[model samples]
Target: MKITREVVQGLYKQTGTARVDTDVAASFQVGDTIQARNINPTGHTRLPRYIRGKKGSIATDNGVFKFADSLAHGAGTQPQHLYSVRFTAQEIWGGEAPAQDSLYIDLWDDYLEPA
Candidate 1:
């Protein structure tokens, strides 16, 4: 089913009704080295398997949004900052990748840590 603007607005409104703090500011800045947390969740997750434990640098702040990990499991939208991270193809693919290529990924705060 197509979710109309009203439906999206309704969901966004509900995001505030739970009394959860979804406005946590981003800790890392653009160009800071970061690594994706090597977590293995059994349920819904947005973290890609290939990027786990890999090192990268922050490219931009994507603002905050409802935490997908919690939202997938019916938990409150524990909002947190999101970012666009840039990783070398070699960092993700090892010797098989070209040095000139890079990959960009949008990740949440909980998924990253200083490298």
Candidate 2:
């Protein structure tokens, strides 16, 4: 895979470590478990508008934790953590979503709220 400089920088921001490389790749499949927490105290991003306040089970693990680069405000990073948390659609979206519909998102350890 073609690694980029931004990806390398992203790892440093989340982990605060510079030992990582851009070529190091990691990914997750379905049915994997993970954790998602709220790091944003004042502002907001695209981390699921509803899941900001509640903690749910990992419905599907997708890929590695690509932390955002400090320069990019933690927007990108390399694949380090191998797991994704999945929350039930009903748990996050409420009764509006179908019973079978669940929300699966790939979040880094910093985003988890601690089960």
Name the best candidate (by lDDT). 1
Model 1 agreement with the true structure over 1-115: per-residue lDDT tens digits: 8999988888856444322345577789999999999999998999999999999999998777788889999997778877899999999999789989999998989999999
Q: What is the lDDT of residue 109 in candidate 1?
A: 90
- The models' CA-based lDDT, in order, is 0.88, 0.54
Give the per-residue Cα lDDT of candidate 1 at 50.
Answer: 96
Model 2 Cα RMSD, 1 decimal:
9.7
For model 1, the superposed segments whose C-alpha errors exceed 4 Å read 1-22
Q: Tell me the lDDT of candidate 1.
A: 0.88
The residue ranges of model 2 lying beyond 4 angstroms of the native Cα positions read 1-35, 41-46, 59-64, 69-71, 74-82
**TM-score, cand. 2 vs. native:** 0.49
